[model samples]
Target chain A: MTGLKKTILGISDMKNLFQSLNNNYSIDLSNYALSSLKSRVEDFMFNYHFSSIDELIHKVESDASFFQLLLNKVLVETTEMFRDPEFWNFLKINILTRNNYQNELKIWIPECNSGEELYTLQIIIHQLNLQHKIKVCLTTLSPLNIERITKANLEIKKMEINCANFERYQEEGNLEEYFTNKANSFKLNPEIIENAEIISHNLFSDKIPGIFDLIIFRNKMLYYNPSLKIDALKILNTGLKPGGYIAIGIKESLDFPGWDQEFTVISESERIFKKIIRKEE
Target chain B: MSYKYIIIGGSAGSFQTVTNILASLPQDFSMPIFLCLHRLKHVRAGFVEALSIKSNLKVIEPNDKEYIRQHKVYLAPANYHMYFELGNYIGLSTEQAVNHSRPSIDISFASAAYTYKSKLIGIILSGANKDGAYGLSQIKENGGLTIVQDPEECQVKTMTSAAISATNVDHVLKANDIIQLLLKLQNKHF
Candidate 1:
């Protein structure tokens, strides 16, 4: 009810922004779901005090630093440690413990935004003393995010929620033992990601890094349009080892055509699927 | 104006009211009804079942990018913000909560207003928060029909009163009257 005016983004304005970003920076966002992208763009403009989309596009095209900032903002990091504690608990109980791998258990975490999920997995592995047995590859779209996460920089404001979620995840250890308090932020224990191979990789355009036993791609596809989602799913399927498991956000579903033939539902409620290794492959 | 979509937002003390509204609608309701209410972040199951208990129509918590279907009632899923995407699809987001609520009422209402324009009908019901106020106003601005439950009859007046203060709502009626109006609209179309 406050007298704050919102700058609406018309369909034409969004199309222009997408075309410009693709042409200038090779940042193709045309495949992203329109609603989420529109909201993100509007939020970015509001935060940066841009009254019009043209001004925002001009700044993005002109300044490298601003463009980098925009990339960081556009890749949403609205995630927390142990998010959906039940899902993590299910991962530990049903997925991780059930697998018997002959080789080191390889896991791929695509788009490790803000590193909350990364740290959460690492903590679980550390708790099980399976650090040597598990090797995790963490990929993200932003190099700046890599720098930030590698430094273990997490906002202090998130501590309470993160800690509460950890409790809900039903872990025995104290969550506070992993963080070192600092000014306006907290540092996650550097040792948690010691065995993690972190790199900058785009899921849409980049090559599939390697075959893996598990792919934790939660919530990443929620912003993608249906065709883009199918494309990404095909890529993930290509990147998974035979019988490898894939887990998406609990609220998300892989209901596209031919998906059932390629992947079997491991846990319908948790959104985990296992690749079907056909006789020909 | 004939509406293609009907969106209702409520919180705190509005569940029973929503159930009553849904219960009154015929099985062949012409337009899709979107219900965006505040819900627990963790409790994902059973909400749709509870909402569908008394209603003749099917209720679903739509998956991300799911295609929209007429006559179905779509409840915003837990821990995710639901959006009325272009191309008659539903888009979900894990963005930070607005007004301390995920499945935010304002986001859904505003998105519906944007997508359906004058062919949308938005209603605000009993609740303790002001999350849907600006969204109802946006619907009004976009030439959609706006309504609020009469504050005097609300279980909690804060939300409806806030909506009334935010825009020139078309109707401020009790729960039964709101149901009657919806039935009339349904009769007019079908």
Candidate 2:
């Protein structure tokens, strides 16, 4: 019982420290200011709560699982397959206008939480009948995603009936009857899932794999600190082929530090940007 | 008061969120609604049929230069944003994410604030990011009506709480109650 209280108090203190750190980064976490100002470090004398936030940080210092745990607790995983219908149509009609099915186009989905958005991209390619033509790759992993993949890939060449509920990518309601149901819920046609590759990687910690023709990192940026966001964007821009397109969540953007000049937004409202390839110096 | 248009933002349970709220409205609902949920830059899917089947409003994945027709819903067509030019054609943008969001609640709300002013109704629903707080305030500042989902009804209140703390919101109601309010606004004096 005492241990639980100590942990809670320790967590509260860490929240304070992290809050302060956030404020320092120019994110106004002003609400905690009054409490922080009133409680001096001396007030912590009676606090048997794990020394300080520093102690907790030390515990997590070498914990590779810390990030994995952080992923499960913090990331948002609510995504549907082929979210915006027309944008897929737009891509077919406007950008990939050529009828050459033999030309290989590469697409990337960064920050692909639990593989829903990545699989959804393949569904779009399938829906547009562009599947046989392009190669799709996904990078990024949240704890929920890693968990989902670990669970999904466990013990079967394919999913079981109940696994449908976990396939938030296949979608739900009204459109349930629109597509063939597999593994249970509205299963994304197996072919679409097969067309794309989902991998575990971090834009912040890992190397930006290679140049691609397109990249999508939707809704994942809003959660990042400004500097982290900038770093993520810089790495993303570096991974883009000269004319590669980069897409972010409806709310995420490239406007950050280290977000050096590279891409211009294709449509500001949709959060789609095209890599603006620079000329030689 | 009646509005020429309405805009909404949300995340998490928002998949069923918009459906549950809008399904109760009339099939021929006369007002135009531009829906902007927090979504990715990947090819958009499922929104049209999911929401369209629930509401009588003609849900469409609008194209660039599509007119903002009355009695219709304009879904952000994916990899793009749905914006208005003073009741003119609804325009699509591939602009950078604002507050790290595309189909940004802020962008849509800001555009409405910038263009429609008092004639717009801006709403904030459930989600994780602090995306629409400033834009909703802008709508209120410009004489437009502002509505926020009651944090209690939200599956995740962090998003709405940010907006609530950020702005002096005009109405805070449960998700169902918000639907009731919108219906009332439709019938009330403009």
Worst 10 residues of 1 chain A by lDDT: A1-10
Q: Give the residue spans of candidate 2 off by over 4 A.
A: A1-12, A15-70, A97-103, A142-184, A257-261, B1-190
lDDT of model 1 at position B132:
96
Alpha-carbon deviation at A48 in model 1, angstroms: 1.9
RMSD of 2: 13.4
lDDT of 2 by residue, B22-79 (tens): 7887876678887888776554568688787778778887754456788888777655
> Each candidate's TM vs. the true structure?
0.96, 0.45
- Give the best candidate by TM-score: 1
Worst 10 residues of 1 chain B by lDDT: B181-190
lDDT of 1 by residue, A66-102 (tens): 9888878887788889998988989998877776756
Candidate no. 2 TM-score: 0.45
Model 2, span A38-134: residue lDDT tens: 1222123224344556654443454546524432433444454445544444555656665354558887777666655565455556657877788
